[model samples]
Target chain A: MKLRSQTRVILPYLGILAVYALLMAVGVPWLVRRGQLAAAETGAGFNPTSLVIYVVVISVVGLFAGLYVNLRADARQRHALNQLTQATRDLGEGRFKELEIPEDVGPLPETQALKGALESTAREIQYRMEAILKEQSMLSAVLSQMTDGLLIADDNGRVLLLNKMAEKLFMISQEKALGRSVVEVMRHHALVELWEKFRGGESKSITLEMGVNRNFLQVVGIRLDDEIPGRSMLLFQDLTQTHRLEIVRRDFISNISHELRTPMASLKALSETLLDGALEDPPAARRFVVRMDTEVDNLSQLVNELLELSRIESGRTNFDFQRVFPCGLMAKACERMTLQAERMGLSVGQECPDNLPQIFADPARISQVFINLIHNAIKFTPAGGKIQLSAWQDGGFVVFRVADTGVGIAQKDVSRIFERFYKADRARAGGGTGLGLSICKHMVEAHGGKIWAESEEGNGANFFFTIPVAST
Target chain B: MARLTLDRELRLVQDEILILGSLVEQAILNAVDALRRRDIAAAMEVQHNDRRINNKRFAIENRILILLATQSPMAHDLRLLAGMLEVITELERIGDYAKGIAKVCVRLAEEDTLIPIREITTMADKAISMLHRALDAFIAEDEAAARQIPLEDDEVDELYNLVYHKLIQTMINDPQAIDHANQILWVIHNLERTADRVTNICERIVFIHTGELMEMDSEDDESEDEDENLDTA
Candidate 1:
């Protein structure tokens, strides 16, 4: 340790001064008496007492001068030692930012070496800290940008680290979630249960549903690569939309089977009747053949509608855009459905306005939508029932309607009527293809329009659609 | 000297209790999820996993017993060891309730569901939330958080009452639905008991914090059967 005070620095020099003064007081007088004795023997004219006084005076002055020089030199060494001590203390506390030794105090060789060592030590510490920071930021950047949620849990199931995607997947903030148990933050039993099963290595992947939004997450728990005791990683991938699509695909298969089987059964029965001696009777054979042909036509139409609907839904079907008069389209649809309405003993009429704004749409597809609606109306309406086809401009689009005084749809089935192969109770009596309304909905939606039905059970039904008006 | 060793033992006991609590919570959640999905395999897995929860509780109990035997813990340390023993007991019972619910799931696997499954789910959710918060209070040694946990149990009770009446109404309307409704009622009862166990855990937390063993949960006045069961539990 450095001697800090000036008195401490000068105390040893003062002690040397005292010892020298005592020696001069005793030994110098003894030597002076001997010298005087020698001078008398030599008979020279010398003053012995004066010589003794002169020697004492010179020794006192020289001792005082040496003491002053010794004190200043010791103080400089103390100052140099103090600066080294301060720098060492700062380095001990890890305050590498300010490890400078004052230039004037540490001018000595030993202090200079000490300062050089401190500077290098501080530089090494700083380099290590910078390297650590860089690695941390790089790892965190990669984790945050990843689409999969990554969660690292300690042995006791506490959340040690979580990435941005993990925050969104678990619907918890990373700040509030750290050090909390997984069950506390996730709040999903499936994930907690998975962690338990995961402990035994029984299951790796588990599906968890989180929050009121019902987000489905497929969490895969993987053991950390270096066998870190009590630490594991969980990767979460959202699978809600995929699961929904799977359900839709399954439902469509069952619906298509039910739809195709009825027509197929009818065709089989008619063909069997003709083969079972109905061929011998001309009128019976002719009637059976015609019914079989109709069934075949219906089956083919169902297939055609299914293909068309799929094409439109998959965005493969393209539209030929044109400004078509709504009155002409309505008139043409009514004309096409006139025969079917007459056959069903229903009155079909057009109620289009003369100056209705033209619509930008695919004419062929629009005609297909209108034809399906009118055919459905003719199929369900009783004899003497009236079907009205109307068109008008509303808002940014021209709205079209096909209203029927028919056995209207039940309120419960109205929402699902536009789904593929969804046949209402009264519509099932008509035995037409079930994909008609679904195709119409897909076609209308493809044309940037919407279609919906307004009806009451045992009352009339009105199906309305809108197409964007042509910008003139 | 030996004081540091005793402190380390106390920490080990605390960690064991937390681990056991999490295991029991996981069991309950898995049991309820199995019930919702009607997955008999998942329900069976929950039942099988109850053994692990039991083993963990017993392991913690053994550690605490050894700690108490070898060392003389005074004041706060003594209270902590005693409180851990009591808290683990409550946790074990909660695990039993989860096992019971898993058993109900197995029985109701093939039956047509007549009652609203959403109500039962709501009851499970409330109970699980209470259990989670109670464990958090215990770990933090927060007396106020522990006191607030029992207040949340009232919501669980209300849900239980709602589930009870709805199940009873179903049994009254359709004679054929009686068997299924009875099984569902048992499931909801197990969830309610789990919520009750959570309150007991909170009470232990209060004891750990204040060194005062006071009943912090409110009485269920509406159900005489529930009150009787609570006393026995």
Candidate 2:
């Protein structure tokens, strides 16, 4: 207040000083010119009445001149001080609004320099702060929306921020997680390891298997220099599905190539043998020829079967389905297997009820499956063994059971019994490009049916199939 | 200009043929592996693949409908598309044949002594060859190859008969052969019929290519099925 008031008082004093200086320059000179006259006029002073009057006038003139000079000096100092005060006010007010000052408060060179500095500094600071704020918010938004989890903690083991993904992965909310202790939300030992690195001011990555299928995710922990003593950022990303699919694709290629190679080799070898002088000996030649023919046939079957399967998988097979009676289907299966059953002396008994409902099925295909099962039953059964085909309605399905008092399937082999090319025993094997039950199961399932088998080693085996009932 | 007909249905039908062809090829390989290695796994795989074939059938059917509705294809294009759908049916049957052979492998694998492995393998090979020829003829529209396939079916028929004869002789020599060998023979027969059907399809191919039907009576030509039963000759 003193500075401001003193500065204000000096401004008007400077105005008075200016006027006094002008008077001094012009009137003083004039007075000097008139000095000889004035001295002559005013020199008459200091006699008691006449002398007292003369002394009073001379002293009064001197006092007025001294006051004017003091006012002029005060005004000059106030002008300098006002410039400083106004410049400070402009700087504080952020003077981008206008770069001008009042005319009465005329700017000095010093005030002009201060105003330029304040505007330039304000602009630089504004640009830098805006850029930094924009980048921070963009990072925050991206982290929050990411699918992978993110965790950032301060040096004191306190949660700083958790994005939405991180919250979902931990099954916690941002509000509940923020400022909470890291140990509270991160219970995994791996995360603890990660957090330990944060404490040690080190960067590391760790993988954890903790998803639906023990899926692995790598968590990378980075120490932030700006964070408090114990802070780090952890990012978790998944890599399981990609890994498994790569293996599956690899296996598929290898398996197909190996499968294709076998038949080709067989064909080449057999044909070479047949061509190599088997013709010289009639009997030997016939056998060689037959073997060669077999190899060729094998190759063709392999190719055809592959085509068939790919076709079915690709949804190119047109199936003709009809509502056919299970009994009739079983009867056809019985007839189909009758000769084999008789040859084996296995008594084949079919117990398909006459009143059994017609099943929505493909008759030819179903009959084919039954024939396959019955054939298998006969093949496994010993002489005089019983092979029975029984069909009955049960719980929205028509069940067909083929049982044989023959060599039963091993429990371990039962699951793969319907797989194509799967042969549990090659020892006393019969002739087959083993694909029957595999095709049967698919055909049955295509009709919305199910097929399975029950068997014990050294006992009997039974194949059961059910066609799902469809209401008319 | 040859004036190629805009047979859109033919395009979809071709897809079905390719799909079915691939499936049958898989089935044949699986069936053969099942036979040679007595592989239950391969058998199950072939069976599983049949579902894909079935699904392909339906998809092809839908595409065919679209083709028929949009293209209004006539004559050859119509025949080819319709034939492709039929071929899928046959390919599915072939898949069943492979399945039957696999099932036999599953069962007879346990037997102490059954039919000769080489013989069954030979029959499967012949049938598969017939299928290959049929597919080739279908794809290339090769009438001569298609017409010639039925003669090859005779060779498969001979093998089928041989399996029957060998099994029967063993059964006659010892009644114990009845149970296992008989079923093996039946499964073998199913595979043999698969070859027969392949020849039948080959004939269809010939008919398609030549625009004339020429059915081969290979079954009658060889007379192997009944002849094997009456081996008095």
Candidate 3:
């Protein structure tokens, strides 16, 4: 491509032609001036008039030979140029596999170096392109096959790229997702916050509670190589299980400590008192001993319940599941909780349609679930409040429900009523560890059933649990 | 030597893991005590005993890895090991944390009242206890308790945050107490990290086996301030 290098090759050929032309001009004249050199040779063969004519003829022949050599040099230059042009055209057409630059085109040293450099450049370019293709396919596969939701959005919150998982998670087709704002589709407040953080080119993760479900979105914002200033990607991962356990573990620790702390401290205090000779004072000793006994019983009960609840949750407990009449379980549950209901001056009543199909369940666990529900109703309901227990056959399942007329659960507390240690009134003391509803939930679930509650602050509350009917 | 397979020995493995988990938890408490008492000897004890913690971790880690390789374990086993990894990480962190506290102790060198370690000690104690209960739930496979651990961490956070502001106040009140106060703050920082770690352990437990997640950020939230704000508003 360089002009100077091209001139070096062309100049030599031009010089050779010039030298031939000079020989034809000056050398022929000298021979003619001599009037004898080639004339003598011609005269030897013929007369003086004939000799002059022969001399002229010899000079003409020499001139033709020089012209022929110059023509030959010009033809070779043309051939090289044509070859170069064809090779360049082929290279342009992307025939990368066979770019053969003719070695003879480099008549000069510099031109030879240029030819080698061009060949090496083409080879390197081919190698790099092949590598890029490989990388592109790998990236495409990864983007398509990944299970976790991936979203790459621009600085203005426009969704630029989304994977299959992302599409499924947002419930949108790819065409609908791209170029749309995240908020328009997801409408999740936490997601919006996450996007803003990402748009700022900051790496962060957010845990969001969507409706009743929990999820984790780990957004990794990297300033992309594009026009968008705050463009980044957000990866959505499902950490709901992990998140729930974390809450549970924390509550368990606090409850256990708070649970154990009271009794442990009491035990410690009682022992110290005994050590300080409180045992000598019979009345004080009696009270202290009685107190110690109560703490011991409470601790034992706590441990035992912890064990039982865990077994029920893990499906490790041997549940002799069977087809049981829902009315029977409800009756027994009320009978068990009757004394407590009476103490609270609340009536426990059941409603059931006769000839109800038998529901498959663990009888004891079902009874336990009902007892827990009624017990809670009795505890929270005011004296002289009414509690109704009912069952109905619906769609191959039996629905058991407890409805209470009392200080109803607040709208906020209603959602978390089933959570472990989720006491509506933490201030109200001397109740269980608040694991009752949680245990009831797990027990029901272990039987392949489900439970839920409905409540309003002023109006009374209703708790519903369902067990599927066993095939006859 | 008897060949111990994971599936056949799951219950036993779980019990052992819980025990080791509790010991590391107790170590976290001990480290907090080291700083609170300003006892170099106790700090040295925590630093020295950290090897024991690591040894326990390696044992658990080896078991988990072997189980994964040999047992062809399906869901629950997978979750248990995965949970164990998190628990081990928390334990390792607590051990490193103990060493960090020891380093602080050696630096402080018998200074009395140069720091405010009381609130931090309270927070760490709470965190340590939380770890124990989380482990207990794991052993019992008590989903309810497991789900509640994160809820408790929020309370720990509140306490640590309280200590955080108090330390800043102390430093402002007396510039001379700044160095000692910072050390106290560091311990509190470690305690808070420990609490967060315990929450991770809790999540692992539930994921191993349990119910669906119903809420987010149940990390020991007192809602004390929120309730007051609502009342005022």
Candidate 4:
């Protein structure tokens, strides 16, 4: 190819030189003859040696001119070829800069076309490279930002890629987890079993619950054959909160049924006794009526407590916010429970620094919380035991405590005491409605506060609640 | 080429060990949970799952034996397979303890006696936590963590003692409750033994790292002996 192109370039120069040579061959001798004729007419001699010298000098001059022009054209063509070679090298090495065709190359039309072709190829490659880079970054961004944990593993179960959420869910770092088997990384039998099943082609996708109780996760594994062959993708959705809510909901329904059924059974048995000739005995009938009245009263109390709890939980109960002094609130609660405490032979006391920060709370709801707590204390404590109410300031809130020298809650029941209808087995026997603490929890939280209890069985119990200090 | 096959086989064995470890862990957790909830059905399920744990252990043992016969791994790989053999045995024994607790749960369901379940649950928690960490140390080949984890066994022992005394007190207070109290005591005994087995697993971890077999509790025993000597003095 190179030889052929060089011949093409040289052929045009050769044609121009041949045409000039033919003109010289014909015209030079004729010019010499005319000189001879002119010399004879003027009675002078014409020399043949002079004619040969003249022909040789004119031919040498014409040949030199042709050689000079050909060399200059060849230099221009070589410069254009060098530029095209450099442009191709840069394109191969991924330097996508524009090809600079020199002005001297304007006469070489073939070289110009080659440079144009090189520039277009470089442009096409640059466009594709940019698009690929953009798509790669977009994929990584989406993977990192996803809420569900995403993991990609190869056919051999070695982890290939995992996003931030997946790393967090598995409590592993990407640097350490990559290229490790999924079974070794995850360490959950159920998950590994699912992976094995997916690998065996038993199922394309599988979902299973892994981890116990509070750390529950719903893991979904899918065979990923579209984007990358023989890889699996796992999506971990943490369901701990959902599981807890499900438990609470189930407990609520069961407890409500039990509470309703107990009183209804008693009412049914009492009416059945009345119908079986117990009404004919006047004094016995009066006793039965009083017992029926008490059962109905108990039922109504249960109903009212359930209604109140649901209302507060649903945020329908409007709290009338007030900046009440902490001591005043404690005193009012103690005063309300004083009569019952005295009847039970328990002494009620309130200890609060008068200078404590006032709390933002619904006065009535806050008082109800305090009264319910004290009532629980009076019920649980021995006849001579003391119930104390105290308050103090803790960062951004005023903390209130109701402590009692009573039979304390068991360790397991301490955390659950504030749950709706959750009664300690011991508390079940010595109970008002079990809704007191649950109501207290909701009311305190409605005031933008927190509530919790501390207890150990056979020792004493302390219930603490916090209300945000009224903004100055 | 043979070395590549050996490495792959070793990874497979490791995966099986982890699977077995998790099975034992879940069994322990479910058994104790069933006891606490008095769910006889869940207890029976845990009892049935013990066979699965046993099969897993045997399967791992068979794989280790095959690797030993075919690959004849040397030095560190040999120690790893040996340590894994010991670990799977210890894990299977722990699984049995879980089954024992499940049986106790079933027994308690038939009686009305109040068991001190809170202390028992705490003991199970401590033991299972120790076991979980020990397995992690084994997987990481961390000699430091393997050595440090056995110290927590003392906490489990202390809980065991607390429950033992509490059950004795229950028996002294009510003679008719002796059978139930003895059963509850057996549950704590199983838990204390589970923690001891976790210490054994930790020992194997250290062995895999340094090829030394020694009791992890020897230091605690020496400290106890000094305490006893001081008391006598």
Top candidate, metric DockQ: 4
1 or 4, greater by TM-score: 4
Residue runs of model 4 more than 4 Å from their true location after superposition: A1-118, A202-207, A212-214, A226-228, A322-336, A349-361, A389-401, A427-430, A449-459, A464-472, B109-184, B220-233
Error of 2 at B125 (Å): 46
TM-score of each candidate's B chain against the true B chain: 0.92, 0.83, 0.82, 0.92
Model 2 chain A: lowest-lDDT 10 consecutive positions: A99-108
Local error of candidate 4 at residue A145 (angstroms): 1.8
A345-396 per-residue lDDT for model 2 (tens digits) = 8899988778888888888878878987887887788898998889889989
Model 1 agreement with the true structure over B92-200: per-residue lDDT tens digits = 8888888888888888887666445667778877887788778777877888988888888888889888889978988898989888888888788888888877888
What does TM-score give for chain A of every model?
Answer: 0.76, 0.54, 0.58, 0.74
lDDT by residue for model 1 over A1-472, one digit each (tens)?
3443446546666777776677678777877787778789998755567666766776777677777767677688788788778887887787777877666653345565676787788778778978998999999999999988898988677899999988986667898889877766665645766877776655499776654345778999887746886688888898889988886898789778877888889888888888989999999999998998888888888888888888998999988989999889888878988988988889888877788888899888999999999988887788999999888889989999999999898665788899876777733545766788999999999888999998997698999999998889
TM-score, one value per model: 0.64, 0.40, 0.43, 0.78
Model 4 vs. true fold: TM: 0.78
Residue B131, candidate 2: C-alpha displacement in angstroms: 57
**Model 4 residue pairs with clashes:** none
TM-score of 1: 0.64
In model 3 chain A, which range of ten residues has the least summed lDDT? A210-219
What are the RMSDs of all candidates, in order? 8.4, 30.6, 22.8, 6.7
Interface RMSD to the true structure, each candidate? 6.1, 22.7, 18.2, 2.1
How big is the RMSD of model 3? Answer: 22.8
Best by TM-score: 4
List per-prediction Cα lDDT, in the order shown. Answer: 0.80, 0.70, 0.72, 0.84
Candidate number 2, chain A TM-score: 0.54
Q: Quick one: ranking by lDDT, best first?
A: 4, 1, 3, 2
